[model samples]
Target: MAVSRRKFISGSGLVAASVAAFPHIARPADAAATRSGQKPSKIIHLVADGMSLATLSMADQLAHLSRKRGLAWLNLHRRAGAHHGLMDMRSLSSLVTDSSAASSSWGSGSRIVNGTVNILPDGRELTTLYELFGQAGWKRGLVTTTEITHATPAGFATKGLKREAAESIATQYLDRGVEVLLGGGRKFFDKTKRKDKRDVYTEYRVKDYALLNESADLAAAPLDKRWLGTFAASHLPFTVDHTHDTKLAKSIPTLAAMTQRALEKLARHERFILQVEGGRVDHGCHMNDAAAAFFDQIAFDEALEVCLEFQRQHADTLLVITTDHSTGNPGLNGTGLRYGLSPLLFSNLLEVKASFSEILKKLSPPEERDKKPEPVTDPAKIAAIIKEAIGYEITPRRAKLLVPFIKKEGEPIYNLMNTLTCQLGQLMANYTGVGWTSGAHTSDYVPISAIGPGAERFAGFIQNTDVFRHYTNLAGIDFRNPESPLVGAVSPDSGILSPHWMA
Candidate 1:
């Protein structure tokens, strides 16, 4: 009963399959038109923050090369009957959006300026998606690889004047009744780390939340109690660094684990809405750290597989996968060697034992007061560090550049380490035919893929705000009210609907 790999691949319809299986897009049971009165009981929306189209393409290609299968999201369209489309992601103030504005578009169904969460330009606070869902008797939760209060997750439930006010965002989560909150940002919750001296963990514990920190606690927490877990002080360690560290591997939970726990807790309710974000994909692209971005992308896709399994059991659940905006514009460009590219070169990323930040810390010892530290004059030492950390041999020219730079007293090592990391990323990409534009968000449409009930509504070119409309519609929330101040007029030219729009 041994099944050959070819037969398995062919049976799955993975290879040689176009994304849209248009003929099978509709299922009679999932058709909204045929439904009597039952609504989708759950909506599991996932965001691969800052994942541009090129990022998706590169990740999909890498998965195919390494495992003979593409990303779960892409394969959903190819193998499963899912709807795929392109979505325009823009903030009110600019074509390019920060996470706050991008997420707020879907959260508030309103385009707010970049940096502000669920707050309109005229100082009005629009209702958030989670709040609306919560009011409609739906349990709500958020899971991410970034700080729980980071812009994307915070947008779903809280209104903040600025994204930097993560401390305030943390407090608002308790106020908004988000039953399951999982991610990092222990600094915002721990008494010693909080600027306000508030012991937010104690506050949540007092509020009957089963507060958990370590991975074991998260795994063992009772399913009946509300759960709040923070596995790291800041954003969870980058997947690339955390996976290789034995201690962190034991303590830290992967994005998929947090997502699974979130689903377990929130799914107990008759109706629920959950957002699971691969928030580090944005951070990796911001640093132009291709290895970090690519690996995190893989982790994010793995989280989607978890959702897919959940959806298989709960057919009433509507699942949506998308990115807030494209970042880094990563591309597969030729590497100077005529027609020579190797996907195997990317394997070196696994050899990167430490992040540049970790390496820089090792290079600079604690400073002695009033004493100037000696410059690192050894090129071999520099080369050795590179070899150990990233498995890349430093060229003579690169070594010459590193040996002269010393950590002077009062000097910051961020610039030196950041530059070196970017250089390493560029070299890795060049060897593997990968390149990136400047480390900034781009004005490009990211792909959107969906399955389960009401998923067909997401097909074709759509505005970012349309997502909010569709989600609310599917969830049976009466978002359109003419009397409500949040509703406004839509601009005919730009096609941007005012937050006050009523259907």
Candidate 2:
């Protein structure tokens, strides 16, 4: 079933969407954090990096986006159907937090300024939730489709001078020893890829741990607490290409694959905490690739499916699924290129890009080769497909630009076509009565859902900073330690974190 989006320009709503991700007010720390009425054997943090309300709601309504299966999160909640809740996801700084600040909000239980991690604007370095979990004798792991060093994952594992400081980010994970570190960003570990001539992977001194990057190597060195894997030269390719290059995606793992591996590894301990990040959902939204974005959301839905499955067996675990922030509101609007509603007319990104090239080739004259010429379109087929998809006929004149714009193959006549598609949801907004601004995060209160022990505490409207204390207070994770230096006091310009906090 297709998603229904009214796309209305509602007045100020969704606090997280408007206030930026900083704390306007500071509340007393909840004493219940450490010794709450309930405790879980495990903690699973499922994050969708740029997930907006519209994005998630639309995905949920699509019904078929998750490969014809129901959304992974929804199905799990329905089956176990225990803790339903909401989270106010603004960071301490900007309403539009880059993944780092947003991730740090939950990671540190305190919102630091935008562009900065948990360190305060003054000069203090706060310990992350995982650090607390580790100190409490619980195991920890991180799984992301993007590079582990990327903002969201790094928010949980490392904090430093800059979000761009991937080199240092890679080093932070080396000694801390998170049980399972799966994702892309192979460049950070390889000397050849880094601007600095240092290969951190080779220098990593953990003895006896298997640093495997290929499927074949997994048997040689199974994923263990002592292991760290980097599977791509860059962020792993879109999920569509995972099978094509297994080596890069092998130990790196999918959202589902890593979620399972983390659960399997961490489950050995009496208690464990895991953060599974669907990082590219935001990237796809940024790139304005609907097919890629939608599919990536599907992949995350699969990961949630796996997380929900684990929750079924381990009844005590607290499962919280939500986005750190939303990108442009991708609300679906009614279709406009309705050319007779043909199924073949609306292909995915690759297909659309390819089809446009093929359609143009069929129209171009052999003699027209090296010269700049007017864009041409084969409206006959284009019209038929449009009709199939939306039940309307597009003019051959309109097809001249629209078809090539949509297909975007090789040397095409349009520039910034992706931007156009991202706007499609917004343009249809007026007609559908839904409203959206261009590529930007809105200050809206994000939805937060929780299940299992203390999950009820997450419901009702709350502040973004309250979220930090919610779990920290639940787990009794402390940030204040005389041994630990004051946080956020250090200036960003100093190019260093306080001595006590290693970035």
Candidate 3:
């Protein structure tokens, strides 16, 4: 049945009213028991990197469809005394912030250029939050699905002129004495993969850091020693692909496992701060892969549940959940008559067995001596692969449209967003009803949800730089990093053409 616009609006109002009327908040006695006005002994900052409002909503819907529950993030909003708000995540170089600068704004309390971390445009080095907290005798930890040296995690602990200098960032982490480091980027630490042939693993071991290489290692790791765990050569595989591969599932740990271990290690210290990032969410959004993004978001939600449970037991811990910025602006678009088919189409996401990246690997041209293969351009072969990967059978005509682009022939359609991944994502949308605005970060104000002591400071519209000040205040540290003047700085559009995936 086709629902009128008036009826839809009225129905939405009723749902909103129902939500408001429910006693989602804790009782007055429960509120009194919380350590709201006390200083937090530890702070756990959880970031769903590149997540948008639409992405969060879709993840909630997916959870309801698959698990018969809402996202822990939203559930925290309904039940916990969480302070929900929006944050303006602009960088010094652009209104649409990249991960490095967005993280630096919080890390250094001063906005830097898009591609730099904790370094001003004029070559002045800004002290990072981890450094300051470390100076105040607080232990620091960084756990992410991306490389441990990636921008989001690096921003809190390192100073670098280039965010791409992963090796340098890894070295900085060791020098700065971050007690716990867990993620991918095995290449950055292995002497065989380093350009300079530096054996960083030896250096970390010399410092008494436990170097872990597999999921089983995390369980046996000693709580007394520091940790440096790298399970993949690069960013961890998407959750969808990881779960489907038995070997990968056993070898690599989930984000929740990493978070659990990091928290356990950090909690052993007198005071500590840990940043848990679902970094692959940004990569999935960059590739415009719906299943990859949503599944990773669910994985992030699971990690958040771990943190939430920790916060419940440790009232002196302050937990903050947020995203650096929105990317791809993904949403579920209406399909069929009066949007009747939208829900059914969105449900198809559950059937996706592999990521677009995984599917693209199957389309690679056959090995030959300077000769292109025909299978890449075969519509029948392409459609069959799509059906096997995502459980959706594309029409031959639709598969034909992907030929030229998949072959990298030319920009036939989607000029600016011309890429096989983006094109495939668009094609998949025809069957799934999920669409993306573009495969890049947006200037939208992302949401921030926090609980525990000091969360109230984040309860309204605030600048990204405010995060640093609040953390300092909570930790009883009074200091400010110097900011560069805007005069003679590069234009916001200077590096606008840089790779969107770099974030």
Top-TM-score structure, candidate number: 3
**What TM-score should be assigned to candidate 3?**
0.91
Alpha-carbon RMSD, candidate 2: 11.6
lDDT of 2 by residue, 196-229 (tens): 9787877663444456574444334453435566
For the record, the alpha-carbon RMSD of candidate 3 to the native fold, in angstroms, is: 7.4
Candidates 2 and 3, the one with greater TM-score: 3
Question: What digit string (tens of lDDT, one per residue) describes model 3 on residues 249-300?
Answer: 7899888888877877776676889999999998899888998998889889
* Model 1 lDDT per residue over 1-503, tens place: 01222221221321112112112223343332323334578899999998987788777776564446678887777645578899988777777778888888888777777667788766778788888888888899899888898989998898846777899999999988799999989899988989999988888988889988989998898988888888888889877677667688679888877777677777667788999999988877766677678767877887887777677657677889999998778887654467454445654444555565555554544468888465454767766766776667777566655443433332224442334444445545644456766566788988999887777788899888888888899887878411123323334554332221000
TM-score of each: 0.82, 0.70, 0.91
Better-scoring candidate (lDDT), 2 or 3: 3
Candidate 3: segments with Cα more than 4 A from true spot: 1-36, 365-375, 485-497
Each model's lDDT: 0.73, 0.58, 0.84
> After aligning candidate 3 to the native by TM-score, how far in Å is the CA of 244 from where it should be?
0.8
User: Candidate 3's C-alpha lDDT?
Assistant: 0.84
Candidate 2, which segments miss by more than 4 Å at Cα? 1-36, 61-66, 76-81, 205-208, 216-225, 241-252, 335-436, 480-503
**TM-score of structure candidate 1:** 0.82
